[model samples]
Target: PGVTRDRRYGMVDWPGWRFRIVDTGGLDPSAHGILGAMRTQTLRAVEEADVLVLVVDAAEGLTGVDRDVVALLRRSGKPVVLAVNKVDSAQRESALAEVFALGFEDVFAVSAGHGRGMGELLDRVVELLGPTARATSDADADADSVDADSEQADPTGEKSEVVSSGAAADANEDPVTDLALDGEAGDDDDAADADDHADGDDADNDNGHVAGNATDVDTAAAEAAEIKRFRRPEGPIRIAFVGKPNVGKSSLVNRLLGEDRVLVHDMPGTTRDPIDTPFSVGGKDFVLVDTAGLRRRRSVDTLTEAVAGKMARDQLARCDVAVLVIDAAGGATVEDAKIAGMIEESGRGAILILNKKDKVPKSQINSKIDETKEVLSFLSWAPILLTSAVTGAGVAELPIAAARVFEQASRRISTGEVNRFLEGILADKPPPAGPNGRHVRLYFATQAQICPPTFVFSANHPTAVPVSYRRFLSNQIRQAYGFQGTPIRIVLREHRKKRKSAPPERN
Candidate 1:
């Protein structure tokens, strides 16, 4: 019941309405320490939220804390919907009478865990949100319906046809033509014909010219639309802020978001759950996850802290970018290096944030960065920024840096471009002889995947390739492609040759 230590935001999409649902920490007015800080955070949420859903435990009845929270909500002058949770069965519905004493007009006996009586509760909550929300929702639904109808009525399928053709053309188009490398060939005749068709019609008459112009216009429009769709990111980039306790992770999040979205106190482990808050800066969207501070396994005393640590590590794995927030005043610690190592292992784009820079004297800022680099030399590729959430210094550059890193991670190098780059590398410095004194020949290289862009190299003896050579290739690729702030993977595979069959013997 005490798991949630901050406000967790989730979006609710109904048939015609969409709303944001925020789950806040348990409120105890007289409590001290972390629990007291949680109460303060809940009060801030109560002040900002348009509607409140007060869930009281039906089994425990209305406690003093519930009554106090209710009093606080009433003072905020916002709509409150009382949900009596844990009403699992019809027999348990009788417990609502006790909760009704809390004086909430819209009380619904619900079972959150069992999924009982939730529909009615949501209906009441949506109703309390009033007409403005419904109007916006309806407008969005109408636009979506219009788009669907337009797609359905397209009998010619011109849009789809052009998109497919454009994609084919892009696939076949050789961006690098000057480099003559093996296994790199020109576009086939069909692709050439498609390109010509897109360029213009093959007729001399005035009518034909007009028709060609129209076709050219359509092709250009389709190509632009396809490019836009291809470039659009799937969703908001999720950047997880992780570090040891009291390293200013939550403070940095609050500073970046320009609000106290999560509870922040001097206490270590003040934040528990990974709070995902949608944020946008410089025309790009991102989800800033403020995770609980992670401590060593030996130091984790309580079960709650252990769970929080696990959750923090899990967040680090799923995030697009892991921002390791180190305490600048304290310098990088053993725990900080461990977290940075975890980020490297996860293969996610990373940024090092030296937080609380104000606490570090100006004269020692450079020295502190050098000290941190020495401790975290394993993650030297990750860009480090000196920041102070208290003074809003160097916080604005965070999202910009994250966007650049994400772009680098998501970048894809075509096979021809990769092979051409490989050719240049081979000419500069070929692979060294193996331990068996046999020459290792690298036939070709191609990108297998992206998002921490993975490249596969086909060689005569893949196993004989040394680690130093692999590192050299990776460094060269990064030097050529600017894959900074992200790790690039190199995979070697044996290039198998086709064997000739003994036809006479088989007969």
Candidate 2:
């Protein structure tokens, strides 16, 4: 097993025992700060362990650092075992003698590579285990308890009704939770109360630690699902590829994955469903959705094409970035522009992928680019890249650009930053005075949360801040902060004290 280090201490499981392993991580005992922390963690692990196993390399021989580790182990006054690994040949047997000088008399020689003397090594391990070894009968007892628990609980008995009901107070203002905890309920009355609680009619958020508590449980379950979750790609950038019939979506996907994972074919509408495959670029995870090519209903001559088109539209809804794949050699078409409009309407980040660039002439490329811009001028902001998935030309850079856009999509300005930006913008273009003689004073603002970061701005006469001015502010925020692909929700709330201080005015 690979060594796992948390702080300075690490741990591993041996048969019938938990070995608290420690890694010094190359800290000089004479050094300060880090060395002191390492020593502290090492001493803590040694104090807790029944048997301390000091592993040494047989081929490399002992070093000065190993001496320091041995000294630390000896000072602990605990049982120590020396495991001299990689002594496969007789010539290396002499190397073990140098390790013996450390004064660990109970040294075992073994070869991890050739599996030599493993049986004898195991016997020594058994002897070291000694008193902490669990009796065979106790193993049977654990199995019986597990079997009983499994039968009594739900098949997915992770949270069970008892555990959930115990925290009902968190969800709603139910007295039964407190009563159960206090053991104040009568047996007959408790059942009736629990039945009412199970009805799920009330909406309460009493469990204050719900989010924190459920993380470990939910993380383990998600890992069990075999879908690895990591940071949303480096820059929160996202790019999607979409096109009309027979455009190389699958071929592009296969190239992106660096394998023949997606099935590619020459036939039009080959992909019937949208498939999402994720990979990392610049320490960020980018999910590439290989969607079916779409076509307008008037242009679609077959039933199969219609199904593929619907699938493509469904994929667009969940995407942050979109790439409109155009067949460059096949020439620019009006249908491609229509598909590009759909991406813009989705409010997703957009990119234009001009595929088959190798075959197109340089002069024609500019004309094609101009043609595309003329047709899809609505997406004037999105970048267009010339790529060939087959040749792997310009394919690598697309994922990075996609990740950059995604990061911009998820970008949220800090409260301080937002207010500062707001101040500067106002200094340049102040909110116009209201018709009712109320001056619209925009005060502090903060990012309420994300998923498309919401901004809450406190101001005097929030109603006086016109819709046009709000849009102006939103645009300023996006321009300064680069929330290019994200839809911003601008909220104008009257200053809390001002709203609260006004006495009830007669309506």
Candidate 3:
């Protein structure tokens, strides 16, 4: 009875064992209306879990949330196995050092997508599970089959209050959102989870995994974790579902996740805070963030709504992609474009969701899509998918399309390749002569950064570069690199050859 829509618990079948994983929806407790309820459920998960799998994004590295969780796991007195998920390849293995800084006794760098390192992670978990696993299940025999393990005896109504007040304070300093699971059990993974779970053939039990040792909590260790945690997430892309109020953002999230983990209502602000849920599709890990819908800035007068709106925007900035949901029945509006523009300004990959298809006639779907696309032309780079969250139509492809877009955003090209591509552009159409009658001589180009790949072009006449030409260069770069669902940024800068100063005489 403790479980609610805010938290959903489920079991997974390994080769020899099964474990119940609880997904919780965490909201800010200070504004404890719904969040307080979520906190209660999360505490229940802690009390029940024999061994907590503290999953940290290996691609995103160890974060402050990881440190806070370490503090929580320690307080709970529960055995914990650190799962540094999304370590797709060995190149990312080096970042695992900082995860050990949290004082965790055992750590496993794994790819939850590829199922790499899972066997060992699960092996150690089986070890901790011990005899307690059988007893937990047998005791909850009359209870829901799904939560048999998760709903273990609440013997010590409270467990010696392991979470110290200080630890709670520190952990709450930057609390992680407790969003829940990926898909429904018994439902075929191929049909239910966007048809994207890795094939059994692709999953390898071995990736040379071993129990990692904890490191000393020295200043250097903390600083190193800080540096790695803040680095741009590489493998498991983060996608945010954002749009105007009552546009089916939460419904779409539930449809894709194959469960009602988030509360969906006709009320405008049903979702008051952002919740981050980790899921996998096609050997690719991703964080699906569901955010509260945005209202017009002028209309958002209440302090509460304002904070929620700001947090939604913050979630957008933290993500690698943003899926803007539009209601086909309501049609595209100015506010929808504004929301998309916000995603564009953040330089995140965008996907347009034309939801509520069941409510719209099949004859009018095309016209509606065309009108919406025309209205939100600013987000033309974003791919549009028509769907009915009610019946789960076309939702299966969201994650696949999003992963493709995230790839383009994170795409990198060699400097030589960039220069060669630029040469073709220059040859196709020569630069317009500057009004000063000086011939514009462009030197070379180099890619500056990615996640919305940016390129910097060095040239003598930076001021002479027109908006039209800049657009042309962006179009050409996208064309050359095949950046279909992502935006490309190009900058023109003055390249003044520096005069060599005479070397100072040495003593």
Candidate 4:
């Protein structure tokens, strides 16, 4: 076991076996003081795993940290499988001599990078695991399911707990959110209700015959209930400018906001903490988060940016959309690709902003854009807009694009349209056949939620649909109804079989 600041996962799938094993190295606390936070997060992920496999280095034989990990795992009471790695390279039967001293009954000598001795190691580990491990895994999965459900805003009249939490956090951070969406309508509605009360036909007249207005009262109540769905307040659309250092993120923020809200400097890592500014344009409100430039995790331990980078990612995760501002002259660097991957993984709507457009020559501008797109092929769906934040050229379009992406993200499809669209897709090219030689059938699809409109699909062989087929379906959906600037998730489920009808009430 060794200490790694970032998490990593490995999978072992032995074909013909019904079970799978996910292996993660033991959580050895980071040497850096600030990186100590990772140990807590590591414990959380490890605790959720079905089984814990601690791979020890045979070259190092046994380390003091390895003993600490064993002690910690024992206290956690999680079933720990120890595999002494690098045995073949160590190439001696005596490689695990020190490891054997620890006396874990299920220990085995193996090489993790290669396939040496893994089968025996896994077989013994599986024998140690009883049915209870799977049960515990499912229980943990259910709890996570409940947590995800709780985080969503309910469309009914009840206010979601997340809604209240977001509101409080937003109010504490920026007062401009108060002017965003929630309060703007209530005052007008209350005034109109007051005037209606003042009229002579008021229902408050005690023991009076208000028979003619009874329908109006009922209708108003019904209308109010319907309006509540649309009236629910959403926090200001959070837009984050994310990229490597010295990419003009702060400068872009100032250009759009008409003020130097954050510091600008020629040197790298000038801005250390994330700065947020709330503003509205043409009555559309947004919260702009300008985060510190992120460096590689290994290099960030001593830099003040160590903590800032984490905060930046946290901000990026909560944003409604992200503006990836990269240097046009620099092209897409490795750090830029990492940031783009983060945007996709976060499922945020993105607009790729190629800043410093003025420095690039006119003849090679299109080629540069093409090269950037090729570099970030995974984000090809995201709209790319060229601009120079310094000169304010084409800068005004950022907000308008943000508004459009948000609108598209929040759009919902009717059940009829979804089913109709699915019908055409299936008729054109059916789902591929399963391995059992049975034809896969996509029974139906429905939109379960909006704002990154998620769809749930029912299929006869849900597990058999290949990734290629899913991608084709997603592309077709995009073509039929545009979701250009947003990402949509598809969840699959087994179709419910119709129960055999009681042999008809015949007799």
Candidate 5:
């Protein structure tokens, strides 16, 4: 019943309003262990959300847990929208009567699976959030009006001319509007023409006179462009904290965030869902995702744990960087190695965090790192940091290290630079001969892509090139370019010779 073990956030935009929705774990008053942690997350969501939607299962009817949840929400003094989910048909509408007794006013019978009665529920939510929604819409409209006015009042002071010409061009070029007019069979076209004429009349009344002159318009446009350029936000680098359960992934996240943003428990698998919290360090933005600790697939006993494991693995694909936390005190296990392999396969920038550093004796730190490295040998390129969430040792360096790794992954080398580096390296250690003792001639090298910098080499026999040679080239490239904390891909392509066409035969 407690599938959502953490707060999951999403944004929904309607015609005139936009709002955020938070889905929380099911509530249970008598819950302990993981369920108690879920209750904490849900209550936190209740504290933060503008409005709350309490979904109840119609088939199960009302229960003690539902009543407890209602009481909990009532205590928060926040508006609640009760949704009687799984109410599939009109016959189930009678079941909604039981829910109204627990609620203040608004309640709806909804079939979430079939998408029934959701609109009324959403409408009621929007109604409750009307004031904020109206403000947001008004702000957006004001911004749009400013942009339109800026476009219309250009350097030439031809505001009306620009507006009319642009409108005419749009009317002529828009196929969708034309199809709509055709569907109306000229009735709507007359009204549209009337509206255009009215707009043109209004433009004429303005006499094409704007307050700003050519110089002013140019200056304003430049200022606006500069402002927009400066204000444009860069997408935050998403970093997922993952490892075997109870390795202190959530603890590390909490340490880095300087708050308990994610739940940390002594019990394993405390965090079921990937919790994404936006954080900033030294002016750079990042989304720190604390994921469910992953165990071996066979070890995943419950369906919920299986789903959680899947979700954690899925998070690796979405993140730019992965912070693989291992228990430094316990040493890296085979499970940790498997998780590291997953990150490498996902092609994400990675950082190995040997957390619980405080527990490990300071004398054994280097040995622990070496042992972990031996187990996770595949991730040798990934930087490793020993951190302790409890003592806050090395926690501050996590984001900085992640940022550096991200930059390294996103680094691109020029073709000329690549070729030069290849020339120098090939001379130092030439490619091994093909199986038939034929020489493998290397033509040239170029960077094919970035964000996990990939290099392509053109050769006479691409397939004949050995994996050892590819590894050698990768190592050389990394050494030359300092692709630290990121994996570099090497590809080989055959340099095909051009075949001359024979003269056409005249018959």
Candidate 6:
């Protein structure tokens, strides 16, 4: 096997992330012992990694070999995250069980080929990895104090996890890690510890660390603090419509346009390059991208085909929401699930568009719908829209659905509204009791931020919020406010003000 240095690095132009991504070759013995060697190298990379991303073949469920790989990863003692690839159907949800069987509970079923599941996967990974903690050896801490001078200067002392990619122009430059991953980087216990260490450092300046370096650190910290405040202006929402060949994605696009804008062909994979067409949906301007069909790896024979497929997938990284078009008449296939999984993995909001429903029989259509629900069960919430490109059955509703999903994805609820909503919910049926007899009182709520709307609720005994109640609240939010086809996040925080209770005096 020929050896080549495939390592590349650079800054990702993400608003709140300094992404350092290492693209290593995968190891598949049958394909190439080169893959095996690559796996070894990749594993080493994983050790230095804040996150471990294992991309699986979605079409080929968790096979015996993939299981073996998972087993190996589990034993590695690293934070193992699974990405089930090529899942593009309503029937493929069952295949997820096979992946779960691999012992990775946190599995992301996605279609890398069609840009699915990429977003949430990254979000979770980043959350888990956190701002890359300085590889501070336990030895880095002196006695009871840690030299957290680096952190103190960091006003919002969130461990800066810089995600660098080898794919960029300048790899050596460490792009500034954003201040906070969460909405607000309040100084927590960890930050307090770092602050204490800083105080101790100032008290006993034995080494006399240079004033210039101190200023530089302070400046970097200041910059990091301000970085959190910097908000990139919002732009038009970019949507990518992707699926397997002859799935009516193009047809649907044409239907949406009410004109033959995209080249609609009877043949699969006719549209080689991803075509971008701008259109208005629910009064919101959107750029609809119609990518070439993404087929199975085995099905991809030619180099041109593979390249085109890659280009189609890369488009997912560029999109805010991805519409996965499935052939409803054909029934939800493993292919459709795989594609759905990809959209999910991309972390982009997804609306599973079941097109060509007019052709399918009633019984078959019902069965297909059930299967679609089953396969997409992993999704917290999303709409399965049945449409027909030939006949405008549900095409008009597609844009409205997309816009609604987008709105939900980017929505941030006001604190006042959340508190009022909480009051109403509690009055209807109070939260279950905690370990103590005291009932949990929700103090207030705030928009933690969006792209899958996240809400933070400050309450008494936040940890005691039952899973059932959380689900109930999630549903209520969706029903009252149109969360529609986007995922919603509900975070619980202990209200400090509620903790200090004093009798209210008559004023």
Model with the higher TM-score, candidate 4 or 5: 5
* 119 Cα displacement, candidate 5 (Å): 0.4
lDDT of 1 by residue, 71-155 (tens): 8777878777777777877777788888777677888777667778789977766676765344434545432221221111111
Question: Candidate 6's residue-wise lDDT over 242-291, tens digit each?
Answer: 98888888788878888655556575665555655567666676667888
The TM-score-based order of candidates, best leading, equals 5, 1, 3, 4, 6, 2
Highest lDDT scorer: 1
What's the ranking of the predictions by lDDT, best on top? Answer: 1, 5, 3, 4, 6, 2
Query: Which parts of model 1 have CA positions greater than 4 angstroms off?
Result: 13-17, 30-33, 88-95, 130-232, 498-507
Q: What CA root-mean-square deviation does each model show from the true structure? A: 14.7, 23.9, 20.6, 20.5, 19.6, 22.7
Badly placed stretches (over 4 Å) of model 6 are: 1-235, 258-260, 264-267, 280-284, 295-310, 345-347, 362-367, 424-443, 459-469, 493-507
TM-score of decoy 3: 0.58
- What TM-score goes with each of the models? 0.76, 0.46, 0.58, 0.54, 0.78, 0.47
What tens-digit string does per-residue lDDT give for candidate 5 at 256-309? 877666777898888887877777889997888888989998898898899889
Query: 487 in model 2: Cα distance from truth in Å?
Result: 5.3
Model 3 spans > 4 angstroms off: 1-231, 501-507
- For model 4 the local lDDT of residue 448 reads 48
Badly placed stretches (over 4 Å) of model 2 are: 1-240, 280-284, 329-334, 370-374, 432-444, 449-471, 484-498, 501-507
Give the clashing residue pairs of candidate 5, or none.
Answer: none
Candidate 1's displacement at residue 5, Å, is 2.0
lDDT of each: 0.69, 0.56, 0.64, 0.61, 0.67, 0.59
Residues 1-507 of candidate 3: C-alpha lDDT, one tens digit per residue: 111224444555555455555544432223244445455546655665666766666666755545665676678787877777678788789888887777678888877577788889767876877764443345345232333332211222211111111111221111122211112123243123222221322222122111011111111122222221222633457788999889999899878877655677776777765766667778887767788889998998677688779988998777888999999998899999888888888888889999999999889998998999899987777899998899999998999999889878767665446655666677667567777776665555555556677776656677898778888888888777787777877777665443358999999
Better-scoring candidate (lDDT), 4 or 5: 5
Better of 1 and 2 by lDDT: 1
